[model samples]
Every structure is written in structure tokens, then in C-alpha cells.
Target chain A: MENIILTSSPTTPYFPEVSFDIDKGICEIRGESYMEETYKFYLPLINWIKDYIKLIKKPLVLDIKLIYLNTSSTKCVLDILEILKDYEDDSGQVKVNWYYDKSDPDMIDEVEDFEAESGIKIELKEF
Target chain B: MTSKTILSYKGPFYIELISVFGTNIRNFNDTYSNARKKLFKIFIELSQNVSNYSENFHMVNNVQRIGVGELFLKELDTAYCFTTINQVKRTDAEILAERCEIVNASDQMKLRELKREQRLNSPGEKFGARIGLIQAVMLSKNQLEYKVENINENFSYFSLTVKIDKY
Candidate 1:
């Protein structure tokens, strides 16, 4: 499987930093995301994960370190998590880690909500 | 309302305008970082609802369609009130009004459960009732108030208000 590396830029203001390394099986999304054109930006990332899961047959690790994300962006993140959960359900190796500031209990609660909703075990790393 | 106007905008709810609003808001309310962040988040979530789903639209360069709406902020002695008004289909207005009732009626824990069910049951569709309203109420720590006024038979003017209590 070929590796995909996307460099993060600030072209559209608070959009997240996305880096998807297929070879290392690590996909990280960081920074703030509040874009209204949510689907246009996230659909590709979702598809990339879907394709990687189908073809790579390797353990995938997903890391999310968002300072803040609008509700639309939250839905998009769930979409990605749903994909990972499906893959894991099929006996494929997958791990999801969500990093948040310890000061923000809301972020922690948000992660727990995601875990409960998706039935996916997400390791929480607090700073 | 004895509160003074912090900011008010009435026009198209284009994407770029959201950034402009955030910048102006940060400039004016820089001292209160926590409250300002909450306000900014609530503002983005609520205003983007108007941008994405507002039935009112206008053409730009005779090519693109843009959503139109009104957003206002007022600083009270103990809290800040945010309001957004836009045009929506009568059907959408009805659904939104009902949703607001459900949201406002529920306590915090119930609202959190509702948000969970909402996110879990949400279809993979690009747009629908997602976490926006839930986040708005959560951040504001107040009930959401919505009003729908008749604007012909198919469309109505929908207004939503959220209040963020100062800590």
C-alpha cells in the first residue's frame, strides 16, 4: 500500500491539521475545525480511511487532538470513527486515541459520548 | 432588554463572514478569554446553522447562491445574549420549533442524553439535526428560545436566541 502524507495549512482559517500516514498506520487530526463546508473537506478523509481499511490489512491508529471543533466537524469525526469501528468489528486491528486538555471537562465528556455512541473504545490522553 | 449591543449583523451568512465576526468579537472581548471562547463557539455553531440551512438565498456574480440571515449579540449585566434570524421552509420551522421545545424542556442530563441519541441516530447525510443545537444550549447554559413568524405559506422567518451566563 502506498503512503499518503498531507501537510496541514491555514488556507481556510481554523481548519484542522490533517496528516494521514498509511505506511505507519497513523492518522492524526489536530487544531481547530469550524468550517461550514464540512462535507467537502471531510469526505475525502473519510474515503481515504475507508479505502485504507479495505486494502491495507494493517493495524490502524487514529489520533484526534482538536482544540475545538464545531458541531458539523464533530459529526465528521464520528463518521471517521464509525469507519474504524466497523473495521475493528470485522476483526481488523484498530486503535483510537483522543487527546484533550485536562482543564476542559467538556472535551472529556464529548469523547466519552463518542465512545458510548459508537461502541468503540477510545483511549483518552489528557494534558 | 437593557443590555447594550456588542455586535449586530444583518445580511448574507456567507462562510467568510463567520471569520469576520469571530475576529471582531475576539478584538472586543479579549479580556474574558473563557467566556469569549464559549461565545465564539456558540456563535459559530448557531450562525453556521443559518448559513447552511437558511431558505433565503441570493446570487453572487449571477453564479453562486448564498444564505442570508441576521445575527446579534448583546451584553447584559450578568450574561450575553446571542440571536440569529433567518428564513426557513415552513416545515423546517415546525421541526425546529418542536426540537427547541424538547431541548428547552429537558434538564442538562436529559439534554446530554438527547444529544447522544441524536448523534448516534443521525444518518450519514451531510446535513440534518446534529450537535449544533445541543452544543449551543450546553455552552449557553440556558434554554433555547425560538420563534417562527409567517412569511407566506411555504416559508417562515425563524429566530433563535441563546444566552451565555458570565462566570
Candidate 2:
């Protein structure tokens, strides 16, 4: 029920800043995710989304503006998208947007692939 | 050692080492921003693979921990080559060699499709779909070259190399 807000740290740029507002139905994950133990970091966020979709029953908007994310974190992102996909399947309103650096084609390809694989429409924007 | 050698680290592949090496590479003057991102991404994926799966380990403070490996970055005329060497069980070496071969032969589209398939089918596996190799190949935008050398009956040394063109 409480919103999760984590400030960004320069020392461990791998861990991103996560802001999930329970009331606003807006979740934003920004920064590089290169955590050594990725599973431990992502499980809670995944559970939180599941809780929001089930308990809040409100429209959700997920915004991701990440500079870098490793393969494990990529898997986590996919897990999050899969959750959103399932929510949409159940007639729950869900929207996802990925803001990627225009210079990084790899990031763009990744977002497109995620959209294709998850069967969830992700609005891709370049900035 | 070649005069083109930019940097090299040989020893236990700790988790934090990846970020340290990445930061240094990012600060290199010759590396363009896009290329630097790709370089760092490939470096982390390859190095972490060594950290997570390398079979060789050294005991520290009465605890057996993940083993050691070597990472080297060398400059060429127009590209920078990143290479990692680590110890693996024979079975893992065989699996990794086969995966590298598969990745080496695929074009970008095929690689993308393969990554998507792996992500969808095995997303929750301990290593999260084991897509590290594919991601490295995608970011490096080059073929993966690897060699598996017999170290002993039980283990073999696996070396993987990816080259990123410096622009």
C-alpha cells in the first residue's frame, strides 16, 4: 500500500531509482541496473506490482528510462512486462512506456523485442 | 605484451570489478559514447558470466567462493577487443562452446528472435533465461569467438572474445 521511493546512488549506478506510487498508479524505474544479486532486488518490485493489480484494481502506467541494464536486469524487466501483460489479459487497464536514448540502437531493439515477446504494446520514445 | 594493450585484469572475477573496469573503459578518450555503451555492456555480460559460472574457486576467510578469471582489453587499428578467460567444468564448457557457435552463426535478426524465444520460455531460470551470450553478441554486433582448452580431466578453460569497432 505504501509507495516505494529509492534515491539514485553514484557509487552503485547499477541499482536504479524506483518510484512506485500506490495511489497514482504510476511506477517509474530509472537508471542503470547492474546489481550483483539481481534476484533479491527485483522480487519485491514484481510482488508489489502483482499486489497493485490485484488490490488497487486501478489503471497502471509504467515508465522506464534506463541508461543501462545488464542481462539479469533485462530478465527482470521482462518479468515486470509479463505481469503487466497478464493484468491486461484480465481486462485491467495497463500502459507501458520506455524512454531510451536515441543514440543507443541496442536499447531500442531491446524494447521492441520486449514488446513483441510480451504481447504488450509499449510506447517507445527517444530523448 | 603488445603495445596495443589497453588494460588487463587476471584473477578472481569479483562482482564490483565489472563496474570498475566499465567505468575506466567509459572514460577512455577514443571510445565514442555509443560504442562505449556497447563496450561496457558487452564487458559486464561476459565478465559476469565468468563470475557466476566459472568452476574454479578460492577459499577466503573459511568460505569457498566463486573462482578467478582473466579479462583483457586490447586496442587494434580500428577496434577494441575484449576477452575473458575462465575455468569451467567440462560439461559447462561444452554447453558454452555450443552456445557460442550458435550465436556466432546467427545474424542480427536471428539473434533477436533467439533472445526473445529464450526470454519468453525460461524467464525465471536461475540465470534468467541464460541470454547473456545473446545479449553480448547483440551489443558487440560481432561474432563471438571462443576457445575451450583442456585444463585437466574435470575442467577446461573457456575464453570468449568480442571486438567492438571504435568510432
Could you say which candidate leads in DockQ? 2
List each candidate's DockQ score: 0.53, 0.63
Clashing pairs in 1: none
Shares of reference contacts reproduced by the candidates, in order, are 0.44, 0.51
lDDT of 2 by residue, A1-127 (tens): 7899998877777789999999889999998888766877888899999999889999999999998888888888898998999999999999999998887888888888888878899999876
Note the B-chain TM-score for every model: 0.90, 0.89
Candidate 1 chain B minimal-lDDT segment of 10 residues: B23-32
Candidate 2 local Cα displacement, residue B98, angstroms = 1.2
Per-residue lDDT value at B146 in model 2: 92
Candidate 1: true contacts recovered, fraction: 0.44
Would you give the TM-score of chain B in model 2?
0.89
Q: Report the number of the highest-TM-score candidate.
A: 2
Q: Could you report the Cα RMSD, in angstroms, for every candidate shown?
A: 2.3, 2.0
Off by over 4 Å in 2: B1-3, B58-65, B123-125
